[model samples]
Target: MTMAQRIGFGTQIRKSPFFDATLRWGATGFSVYNHMYIPRDFGDPVQNYWNLVTAAILCDVAVERQIEITGPDAAQFVQMLTPRDLSQMAVGQCKYVLITNTEGGILNDPIVLRLGKDHFWFSLADSDILLWAQGLAVHSGLDVTICEPDVSPLQLQGPRSGEVMKALFGDSILDLRYFWLRELDLDGIPLVVSRTGWSSELGYELYLCDGTRGDDLWEKIMAAGAPFGLQPGHTSTIRRIEAGLLSYHADMDADTNPYELGLGRLVDLDTDFIGKAALARIRDQGIRRKQVGLVIDGPPLSGPNTVFWTVKKDGASIGTVTSAVYSPRLDQNIALALIAAEHAVLGDRVDILVDDQPARARIVDRPFYDPKKTRPKAELKAG
Candidate 1:
């Protein structure tokens, strides 16, 4: 029998609805995100990566707090949050957007879903956008109700995720287009199912509307997916790095602007937003630093970097390695870094202080693997 894990923390930290279910399913480790305990370990992370890419894994990402905005003025109020052109956003469509501060710095990156003409939900990353949105609504003349609902999200990701989804909801689930959401019911459990996931694989995220049904929802998914080799797993850092996906607070934070991260595509200057003037000025002035990919010349990284490793070029500090990890598929240590734009040349050699030891590295493309994202956005076969 496995030894019982004891956790010591104050009541301030919240627990997800699937906490008990995950613990019963062999989740042995946890990490705090958005003031909630998230399962980060279920054994070997490398094995978890293989499971996510080869088969499928169910992740309790309940920490992705849903900030619901609904009111007569919700449509106009939502547009003031991000620079993205939501004018053409249709009901049931989801958009990945950035919430910025007055300085144009990213406050939080959330996926906004248009549930109705004036109803929306901002499924957030690590930061607290609920407070930000609520605080903003206090003074704005817009009529909107901003609050956190009883919703929690679970990611069912991998190449085989489709097959598993079909088994659960029938073949109709396969027709759901990418980045779109539909209200669904499974055995009396109310949910908002979306053809979206963070794994950069063909996957789905099931948003449990009722928190009380967490255990029931988790068990149902696992049972339905057992035939397809489904495993209880955490989000894979390796696959995310390989896909060139960014992690908030690691790859970016409140101080990081969209242009510096090459995410200017998410910023639409033509639209009026909270930080439009600041972003416009930054765009005209050009960015001083840029985020890039690097191939660290060393043994495979044991795990993700815990600190910002210093990057130097010709004995001068140029930038810092934000996030670094070994990609088992690539068989190399790849990293994402923010460095001076002048030193961001591809194929340029730089030295990074890994664990206080000097290691040689070369500038490479952002994504070490699929550049065009063909895997996640691949078209499904018609019947």
Candidate 2:
């Protein structure tokens, strides 16, 4: 119910190039992601949520670290990291993938981008995947160079994001298909633009090739977005929960496998990968618990949950709520929970303890909002 203690910064944690800009724009709080200070709140969470849904907003997501893998055997090496079948992945395409340990536990869920014939970047979540990949490479004697490139990404998201992007990058950016990327220059500054984002909305990510240009790029995009009601915003927790986007380390972690997180579609049993055998066995035994959505019948939560709340059935603990938010659009408190596989049914009723008080909840299908998933790829209509 009370605000969290303030975060202190040190050399142990790195700051993004846009840190100053976010602080200047009224960033009220911070959270560490991938060992970097990420702006967690700019002001009111509800307003930030609304702005992202109705207008355009900019987010400094440089914490989405990039693990660069390039070499003659780059593609081969990358394939050995995950269960996803990457044989058909074309250059300039992005795929949502999970890097698993040999035990079939999820290591990281990242958006794998193929930039060239022998180059790839894993736009990672909050995990030390770079070291994991490097260790693997060294042990396997793979012919590849692995490093974290100095590329920081900014996300321009919302319904009006396309317009803001068009104003800054020209109408040609409109042709960028969802989950695809393109390389371009802005005022001679090299950049990689991708039709991708965490929120289930029309959006694009601009990866800065020059870290020094971070302020310059932010200013240009903000100025161009001024006409479209652009605001400095942090990643929207409400929107992500509504869209059923999983947050790394919260919904799942290294101990959690793909099937438990409803990511079985991302695993390819036909492919040879590090966790293929373990996952195949998991498939045969069946998952014990699985992730599902929840509609809580209670008052709005006071703030973002700092700890996992217990989910119960018949006054007995049955699962845990990892992430929860009050969605104004849906007018109910929603949450993501990992519950017993048999209790993960759509209509199962359960109870959750929020702020130490009991509250009733029901199991629901994921993506409490935009279940049809038509927003992220929708074209911006003429204003």
Candidate 3:
């Protein structure tokens, strides 16, 4: 039997609108994110992983906080926040952006959604980016208002997700292209729906505009998705690891640069931003360590690793495994590791110290499940 600890709830850590619904549906574990409680698991991780891949799953990812930026200079001010050139980003489109410090360190990787000509939302990861944007705006004299709006997001993900969405919102939702969003109204409740998700599966995120209707919205989705084998689930570490998705504060952090994390494409040197100079310098200097994928020779891991497992080369510590899970589909323990650039080449061998015992491992390409990534962006026919 595995020992578990109880998580005490308090006002300091806010609860999502679907908190009660998640509890009633059997949320077995919880974790704190963005000062809010995120449902970590419902039951077995392996079962949840299978469910997400085979059918559909409703996730309470309202822990993804939103920071709204609006005003005349909103576009320019928002552009100053990241190295990505946002000049070509059309309204109703979303871009995965990294908010870096002046030192070129990644502060948070948020989805930048353009809501209107002068309005944008930074759907943040697990960091307090509101203060960072506010502080920057204060000194820059940009005519933009920055604050967290009353918006919360819930994700419906899986192969059958499009069918559930079509059932709930009709055929128009099917027209939404990948990374595009549209304002929607369901039963008089206003929302913003986006074709995006953490899992590399077919998914959509419904951003609840009205917090008071959280329970009602949750029930409505549950009822609509019941016929499609939908279940309440948390984000699966196994699926994410298989997809090579990076979790903030897990695979990378404030001290980690985007280039080292395989996010160099996000940095546009031609466009000036907060970390442009530093990133340019880093690009010129080159990175010493790079994040890479690993396949390990071992039995299934007990659970998701809590700390970085030491990775060694010839008995000397060279790097660490940031995230790892035993992939049932691949039949091997896969991991995302930060290793010396020299050792990050494909097929390079290394040793991973799991539970103090060294296990043989090799460098491999990521997205261990689907290399083509066709599922998430595929068009689904209406049922």
Candidate 4:
């Protein structure tokens, strides 16, 4: 039995290539590989990459998630775990689904990518979602074999992603739509192209069959994008911080509900699935804590893991900061926090505890960076 099994917490596992590569890049550079620990002393990407105005960032997120479900009842078995109705999912389509426990806590956010009629892969968080799915399968007596495919995913994100992709893979890429995916042969090698990314920028995830092909794809994209200013980039937590995207375990965990994490849209409580009852209760009864945006009054926050937020209107601790960062895009210190539901209204002024000292902050809407969500889909050029 694994460590998770000994602890009886399902199948929690470590990331394959887990390490921090920030210092190796150079001075004032840092990166978090596969949702590991927050590293020390590194400048935010927005400060460094902003002058380029537009950038093509490459990220290796192979450890993000990879769960394979194969069996006669694979589709039906997986469908029972999510509240989103998957009966209409046609083959060759991918849908974002939330996996919830019986108490309605999110297990791990994963994308249900349909590879074929019988084959489906759940791209997941670092958490042990594979064990959870397997336990459910066995408990329900469903005959299915779940495993992770020997594959690594590369995220090519930035304004110039499409242009660079076209140069490397040809014009056929333009045919794909947001959230859509296709399998194609690039230079005699088969690859999967999914129009998805985490940077909240115009990006595409090319799932190469093996790690050997990754170098070729990387070199090809970089060479094609040299003119477009493409560069190797890992996950920019600070950039994502500005984007208002919540990181798992950092923002929300088993202790928090989706509604409290500003992700209620991801939960379809109307359907019959695990945690549907609990989620309904949370929605109807209302959440005590809410995720809110914080605009720091003082200097920018340097890293993740600091308790610099409070939900006090007039000297009372009502909330706490979950994720904080210095936003280079906004040129201000921004944070996401869980506060009393009443104190979460937009434009409400609150106090943030910076270094044990209270600093003035204001509650704002989510996505402190891009309000329009314009980066996911590229604009079609006029023919």
| Top lDDT hit | 1
Q: lDDT by residue for model 1 over 273-364, one digit each (tens)?
A: 89999999999999989999999998888999999999999999999999999998889999999999999999999999999999999999
Off by over 4 Å in 1: 1-7
For model 1, give the 10-residue run with minimal summed lDDT.
1-10
What TM-score should be assigned to candidate 4?
Answer: 0.85
Model 3 over residues 253-339: C-alpha lDDT tens digits?
988999998889899999879988889999999998999999999788988788999999988888999999998888889999998
Rank all candidate structures by their TM-score, best first, as comma-separated numbers: 3, 1, 2, 4
> Against the correct fold, how does model 2 do in TM-score?
0.97
- For candidate 2, the 10 contiguous residues with the lowest summed lDDT are 1-10
Off by over 4 Å in 3: 1-7
CA lDDT of each prediction against the hidden true structure: 0.93, 0.91, 0.92, 0.71
What would the TM-scores of all predictions be?
0.97, 0.97, 0.98, 0.85
Question: Candidate 2: lDDT of 34?
Answer: 94
How do all the candidates rank in terms of lDDT, highest first?
1, 3, 2, 4
Error of 3 at 115 (Å): 0.6
Tens-digit lDDT track for model 4 on 151-211? Answer: 6667788787888788876777777787778887778656788888777778888777754
